[model samples]
Target: MKKGSLLFVFILLLSSIAASIGFAQEIGKDKLFVAALGDSITFGYNLQEDKTKPSSQAFPYLINEGNAEVANISFPGWTSSQLLGALSNQETLLALQQADVITLNIGSNDYLQAIGLQELIENQTPIEFTPELQQKIAAASAQLSQNLQNILQTIRQNNQTAPVVFYNMYNPFGASEDPFLLSLHQAGEQITLTVNQQVLNPIAAASGSLLVDTYSAFSGNQAAFIIPGDIHPNAAGHQVLGALADQALASLVPAAPTVEIVFSTTEKTEGPVKVTVTADQDVLEMKWLPGEQTADKFSAAGNVINGNTFDVPENGTYTVYVKTQEQLEAVKTFKIENIVSKEEEEPPAEEEPPVEEPPAEEPPAQEEPPKEEEPAEEQPVTEQPQEETPVNETEKEERTSVKEESTTPVVTVKKNELPDTATAAYNYTAAGAVMIMIGAGTMLFRRRRARVN
Candidate 1:
């Protein structure tokens, strides 16, 4: 084979081995652990298919990717303070410690309950911006600030390296569209904006984590995202939220992590040598490389796992590689001795040289009368076959044409209930992340956590 073809095959072989190892790892592993802390959004409130199972379209299940196990400690009507209180719960803290990713959304309920915005929304009365209410909102904002920092601190204490995702609040109050309610809507929106900027942003900055702008993701798109007659996001909105979480997980996944390769037997005396390579540390994937590839390019793409076994076909050097979700790569090389087969081991028997002999005198040929073949001159006739090649070919073509005509159209397109944001980059831009305020028609705590998407 050409060198390029050999390289391609080498890559493919490694990928296959990597896939097998990864498959085995996946089968052997427990599902990826993910934890979320927040309010009703995290709890998956009204969008229930039943009491026991949460909505499949809810952000966590939507982001499940079939391999993640989520510990959603959030509950309905949970304010930031309530989330802080729940952090003391053993089950919740354990989940955080074991989580590969965590998401948090809080403070919205705190703001809403404090400002009594839900009461105002229900009553259809103009909010007087009462002095006492302003003090409460300001106090709520302070609590939100402190609670957010504390939440992040607690998460770090559990899983210091797992990425944490928190989103800004969305505005759910029906705004200026209603002339009589302009002031109320405007005031609520202003408060939502305040929480996103003043409360969430600084905390995210301090924690060195992501602050997804749910406000941006849901703003103006409420008709598609919010529940009818309620402030919480609808099932569709959950997808958007999930997509944001997915993006954070995708981006944070470290490049293929470095691995240490191990071999069961580094040297071989015959064909079919089995060498097992391994990484000492935790890894998401692993690969086996043939002599043709450089270790540098082994991690360009494809899933791999902790250990892989290879059947060496020839006497040559082979490299084993390991990769982790953290983007590290480890390599080790081992050589197999020139292979010796049993058949080739024995010596050949000796043979004597043959004696030379003089050429024999030309034997007198018996004279035979020359028979002249005059077929062309005599116009010899030839028999035609029963079927002509052209005729048979034409019949075959006709049959093929008939078969083609009888074939039915195949279905190739499919509709997905979920959004395809797998390739969508997170829109961190303020212009792109339009805030959609959502609450109990009053406040929104949009904290969410981060992992294994």
Candidate 2:
């Protein structure tokens, strides 16, 4: 019984030592604890379907390629004031306290609000940014500066040791070729530069935070970095930004190894296109989506196909998403302007039957001589007209005399009083004659009797 107790106590001592060693190693680990906070740029808008969650292609995910612990607390359409208000939350304060590196990019929405940004993006109309509005934005910028300073102070109070990397704004619409957008582009660029130069630079310097010059990095290259119709950075742009942030934190934590992804397409620009992705790391899987979009976890949100080659029946933008064995993802976009449809390619075969068979079959019908017998079949019609001709001729003669009979005036006199009066007179004369004859016959009879006596 004594030996059994000693053995148990010896086992407990080793277990306690192992626990202590594990805790020490965990505390001494060099992996970074990154906290991402800001607006839609850090939240990765348009990169995925769900706006409430950060995308896998966001800068936080790209920074260590999911190697370090990251907490993305950014939201879309958040202004500097809102971020300042959020710093008082217990959960936000806790995350900041545990962070070894914190990335911040706010104040874009504060300036965009003056130019009707939401209406402009939805309606696609140019922002006026009139002189009065410019003055208003300038006044608002002063307030924004104060808000940013307060936000930094709160973050510093929560996390005194972590390096805060603040990114300035970039003019995503500056490269637009539209004439109406030109004014907006200019005004936006000027405000962005002013904010970066006067506001962010001084605050970052005073707060002992690192200022990442995103404006200079994205100067005329917005077409490559920004999403086509949106103001957020694309997958490639996020990767570049992540690299910049990683460079800023290099002194404290080692930068992650770079994964090289090379994507190319077939020589033909339009039909039956082929895309090939070659990387230094082993490729795990890839997905294809139409238009421009980044990859998410397991290539979710079906936009493109699931293969490397495509023979689609459309002509537009297509994006290819590739994932490596190390769980790193990359995206590439290609523009296909023309697509030759199968119907168009088979038109010659379809036309051959009509072109050849119609002529060959129609000649026999034309040479049949059946049309000559058609007139013979019409002979009964002529016979039928001949039978009715004598009746028609009698009718025509009667019709011809009707006008002459009507114009003669004999019928008119008979219709008037002359015929009636003539008839009456003839009747009277006949009656008188008859009466005289009767009287003469009676006298002759009497004279003959006297002569006889």
Candidate 3:
């Protein structure tokens, strides 16, 4: 071959390899799976199911569109401790482990419940303070903090590479000067702030975890966004929250090379399994990083390059991390050993018993004699002479006439009584007449004296 032809062939080979790398990196683009774990707020209470879609909100939706998946496992009345318990459960842990993004909106219920207990204490009979109740509140708050910490720890243990976002509680109680309301809110706020500062912030800083601030977001617009007569946000409120989640996710996972990777298994395992991966940008290669037990046991088929699978070897715990062509990494964990197979247990055998015979019927009893009928008694009657009465139409007419006459007199008296304006007018007229008389008398006396002089 000529030198020019050989150089062209080499260039073509380089272009093809570059194209393949770019295709691999674009996997799992615009797709995301998220597990939203929290109370009613995280569940988007009163929010339409479709409205909770990632494409609806700017924040969470943005993150969702970025090849992320979300699974909302939020319970309405769940507290932080309840969430911790739920997350620690084998089933919840397995389900949550599959998520690329995990968002938590707990602690509000804890604070709310605590405040309720305080109210109950305040309203107690005999006005006696109990050391036990005080201790309970303090203990609950402490446990809440600890539970939040434990939840973060569990997530980290299961999926260290997945970005775990903790959203701080918003002010459920709006700005009110009422002492009781204020005090309750203060208690809740204290717990919330403490958790964010002492527990969540520390965990995030230490382990590269993400923190989303929902407290400040809802504080300013509490009246407009918050649901009427309830602490949960309305539709507009969810929108605001979703926006915050989106921003948090974006910051947590910036635009980078991504690849979609899927695993094929003969039977579904208790899985945090990879279903698919689509590339978003250019990259050199792609590979599945399997868990400890599943590693090096399975191989890829078709266009799936460098794919692998593993059986969840143990019941206790496990973690798996994935590496992309651009070196961007994501991790998920599963508790495979805890899943029970229904086919393994055997059914109990049926048993039969002998039947008992029925007893014979008894004979009827003898009839009783009929009693004699009593004769009806007649009622006694008495007659008395009626007295005659005389009609007095004339007396009746006189009484009616008297009443009419009295009413006429009363009407005349009321008419004769002077009104306030009339009384004042009469007094003014009398005073004017007296002044005229005095002036005339003085003038006449003065004229007589002048004539005499």
Please tell me which predicted candidate would have the highest lDDT against the true structure: 2
Reference-based lDDT, each prediction: 0.65, 0.67, 0.56
Q: What root-mean-square deviation over C-alphas does model 1 reach? A: 48.7
lDDT by residue (327-395, candidate 3, tens digit) is: 565444344443434466568766667677687778785545334334345354332323223337685
| Candidate 3 residue runs with Cα over 4 Å from true position | 1-28, 48-69, 88-90, 117-137, 177-188, 254-453
Cand. 1 TM to true fold: 0.52
Indicate whether candidate 1 or candidate 3 has the larger lDDT. 1
The candidates, ranked best first by TM-score, are: 1, 2, 3
Instruction: Give one digit per residue, the lDDT tens place, for model 2 in 1-453.
Output: 356434543543343333233323333455668888898898898888887788888888776444657788778999988888888889989998887677888988888886677777668676665788778788778888778767766665676566777788888765557765675577668778887888778766555566788988888888899898777899889988988886665544322223333334434444555445444556676666788876663345653434444454467787667666645567777777555555544444444444444444444423232222222232221111111112365654554444433332331322333322223334444456566667778789999999999
In model 1, where do residues sit more than 4 Å from their true spots? 1-30, 49-54, 64-66, 128-130, 174-176, 255-453
Candidate 2 Cα errors over 4 Å, as ranges: 1-30, 120-129, 251-453
The model with the greater lDDT, 2 or 3, is 2
Each model's TM-score, in the order given?
0.52, 0.48, 0.44
Residue 193, model 1: lDDT of: 88
